[model samples]
Target chain A: MAVVLEVEGLKKKYGSLEALKGISFKVEEGEIFGLIGPNGAGKTTTLRIIATLLTPSDGKVTFLGFDLKKHPEKFREKISYLPEEAGAYRNMKGIDYLNFMAKFYAKDEAEVREFVERAKRICGLGERLKDKVGTYSKGMTRKLLLARALMTKPALAILDEPTSGLDVINSLEVREMIKGFTREGVSVLLSSHNMLEVEFLSDRVALIDRGEILDSGTPQGLKEKYQASNLEIVFRSAVQ
Target chain B: MKNFSHLLIKEIKELVNKQLVISLVFMLFIFNFIGNVTKSEIKKAMAKQKIAVLDLDKSEISKNIIGALNMANFIIEEKSGEKEQVVKELRSSGLDLLVVIPAGFGQEVSNFRPGEVETYSYLKGISMTGSRKSEIVKALLQTTNEFLSNEYLKKKLPDLDPKLLKAPIKSREFVVVRDRMAEGSTSAVIGSLYAQSFILPVILMMIIMYSSQMVITAIAMEKQNKTLETLLTVPISRTAVVMAKMLAAGIVGLLSAAIYMYGFRNAFSFNTGDIAKAMSGVAPILKQLGLTITTQGYALFGISLFLTILVALSLATILGVLAEDYRTAQSLTVPLVFLVLVPYFVSLFADINTMSLPAKILVLAIPFSHPFFAVQNIMFGHLNMLWLGIVYNFLFVVVMLYWTTKIFSTDRVLTMKLKWGKRKVVL
Candidate 1:
């Protein structure tokens, strides 16, 4: 399969602290790649750099043959980034927020309507889509944001902690949607602390700690190589 | 450009929120209602100057002086009580003046010597009225002295005409304007002009201050809500983003200024009507002074005023980006508030034309000061200064907008944090 995104020698420094030191990874077409790490393990920083929201101190990120640094706007057109703790405009309705996000990709009213319909079906917000995002519950908001990310049908989706603060039911729903992305031939770069969820969703995983990638392989491959029963034990073994 | 319209629409919609709309309407109504009330009060006739006299010398001359005070539109209340009691009443009643005649006052005047008639003045505060009335009283005293001396001369030269002795050379004062004699005090006519020019700056300040604050708060809200990151990631250029924000904020500011001007104009235009009526007799003088501004001049002034407001909004936008939250944003606006108020107070009293070179340069250096002088410059046909001010303001705003756009393009906008001691405040 062709590689959809390539991140090589990505180095990010915040003041004197080096957040990402020479990190590299790649996501194949229609593959779910997870960066599994602890807090402050440079997971979000790497995603932010890939999203073109932060410029790397030293790195090269190529998305679909386009250099991200030199052509961030071009990269933005083919990718959707959902930051951790992202919020929609409070005064805007759920449908309105979807339509707003859709306009960035759709050219005409008919295309925008089609995107909105897809987002509605994915979110399953039904009747509550007309309510302002400010009035939505946390789970419902997360679901709507997930739908927003998928509605554009971008080539790559960068999600940072997609299910960080959701309950069990919402987490399941979000995981199901993320799994649905691969079926549509959409590549994903996700970061998470929940090893079990990462094990279930990620086709391949990278064990990262202290701004360095310790290892990268299939979830089952990492587990077998570390003589571990699961990906969590594999992560602990590799990082420790 | 496509995203610019979307962003601008979103910004304007946010600004015209229900709470802000209510506040705007409330400000409009209160300003106009109170303005009308104050307008009518100013139109009323001047109140009488209350005076108290402790006349210890019960002579004809002292009585004549007291009568003269009363005839000068002063309400003289005779207080025969002790000095302490008189002083207490003087302080309590807010009297304008108090005169104490010594017991031998009549004897001194009869001897043709300068009498020591003590006068006490009770002025409430700094006002033009108190000083103006004091000047009038001083002139009256000089005339009274002349009357006494003239009486002495009439007795010594009984055969001479009394009129010739009192006025050796009669002179008539005439104000010449463009070879035409004009009526009305020069001070009154100038005061009317100054009053007309004064209000424009105040209205401009209200618009700039209020609108700048809104822009700051809006940017701060985007940061607090974590929406700025998403916005920056959009496919739009940074310049387009900054332009959208500035244009939207400018639109809101103009709307607010329009509403405020509507209220203030109705209230102040009433007083202006009275001034126009009173100043009709001094038209030739006004024309000679080149104090009549054409509509084209007003249009130029309006442009300068708009540019001044844009500079303020641009500065506010920069401050907003540096702020961590809404509270920090408001604190950051202190510099802008000072910039506005300093010029506001100075323009109210200082005649910029007569200021020293250094003072004039200092005032003109502040971009806000130009708007304060807009009406004055236009009225006096100071087109050079007006055009210079407009250019200066335009350049200032352009520079600020460029800087603001550069800020928006940088990563510093997201990473810049205000450090408070050991803690870092990041939005």
Candidate 2:
């Protein structure tokens, strides 16, 4: 399979504290790859660096034949990044917000309309999309943001917590949607701390602790390698 | 460029929302309400004032004094009661003032000695109208003194012209601006010019203050909402992003300034109209003195004003990136607010032309000072100085925009931290 993203020796520092210490990962085409860890395990830092929101202090990210440092705009052209708990313009209707964001990616007005129409159907807010985004519930906002990320249909999508802050039902719906998107030849690099959820979702899973990836393989492969039942026990056994 | 336009349109829509429109309408209504109340108060102050008079002399000069006071818009009511009693009962009896003409007062005036007229004024609360009423009474009394003195002079100098005897010297004042001169006092010409063009500086200040604040708030809200991270990763030129935000903020700032100017004009329309009418006789003199702004001068001033506003907006954009949330945005704007306030107050209280060298340099160093000095610069044809100001403002804006774009391009936009305390990051 063609690789969609490559990260090598990625190191990020905030002030004097090292956040990510030489962590490496790769995302291949048409696969759901998850970086699983605790709250302060550098998952967000790694995702942000690849999304071009932060510069890696000591390494490189190559995406779609473009170096992130040298050609960030080029990297941006083929990817969509959905931050954890991201928000839309509060004063705009959900449909209008989608339209506004769609223009930045679309080549013409027709493409913008197509993107927004896809977003409307994917979000499933229906008449609720006519109301201002400020009035949306947390689950509704997360769903809308998920729909926005997929509507662009980019070559790669960097999702930081794709189902963050959603209820059980909403979480299931979002997981199904993300699974559906990967079937369309779009690769994904998502980060989360929900081990069970990630084990159920990612085709390949990486167990990260502090700032380093301790082990990485398919969920079943890691579980078998560590002689554990689930990916969570595998992570505990790998840490030990 | 197309994405830039889309961002600009989105920014404007976000700024001019339903809540903002409703707030602006409410503000205008309050302004108009206050304006009408002030007009009624001013009219009451200008109406005829009632005064009580106690005449002990019962002489012809006393009668003449009372008649003169009555003719000068005072409704005189004679009182024969005790002096202290009449004075105490002045305002409670619908009188604003009390005058006592003592016995033999007319004899002293008849013998060419100045006689004193005792006056007691009722106390009123400290307000503009209250002071205006007091000033009217005070002015009428001075005029009456002049009349009495002229009468005495006529009687004393029977063979000579009393008018010429009273003023030994006659002089005419003329004001000059560059080579052009007009037959008027310099102060009068300056006053007329200020009266007509003060609104420009006021509007400039309002636009800068309102617009910069709006930018900071917008950036802060984006941060608070956690939307900035997603926004920065989008496929658009970062420089274009900065430009779109600045331009949208500039447009909204102008809109806010327009609404504020409308409210301000409505509040002071009566006073401004009165001043224009009072200075009507000096209109030709003002023109001769070159105190008016020409078309070319106005165009130049407008450019300078635009550049200054851009400079403010650019600085504001940089400051806004440092803000952590909506609550932190207000304190972050303090520095920019101080920059605007310095020029505004200095231009109001001191003349930049006549200021000391150090003070003048300091004032002109502020980019906003250029528009505040526009009136004097246009009047004196200080085209070189004005052009220098234009260049300075342009360079200032460029430097600020470059710095802002640099921040946006780098990881500084994400990791930049600002804190009120040494160890805590507040914004």
lDDT of 2 by residue, A65-116 (tens): 8898999998788889999979988888899889888888999999999999
TM-score of model 2's chain A: 0.98
Q: Per-residue CA lDDT of candidate 1, range B1-427, in tens?
A: 5767888898888778887789878987888888767655544214566667898888888898888888887777887967667877778675677788878788888887778676777788866556656765677677777777777777778788777876799765454544445544677667767655666677878888877887888888788877787777766787877777777888887788778777777765645676677677666667765667788987997899889878988898888888878898888888888888877988887889899999889888989988788777777667799999999999999899888887787667777766555466654
Clashes of each: 0, 0
Highest DockQ: give the candidate number: 2
Residues A1-240, candidate 1, lDDT per residue (tens digit)?
A: 999999899999888999999999899999999999999999999998888777899989999999987888888888888888887888889999898878878888898899899899888999999999989988999899888888888899988999979999999999999998779998998999888999999999999999999999999999889999998899889878
In order, what DockQ does each candidate have?
Answer: 0.54, 0.81
How far is B272's C-alpha from truth in model 2 (Å)? 6.9
User: Candidate 1, A48: how far from true, in Å?
Assistant: 1.7
Over 4 Å off in model 1, which ranges? B32-185, B265-275, B353-361, B378-388, B420-427
Clashing pairs in 2: none
Against the true structure, candidate 2 reaches a TM-score of: 0.94
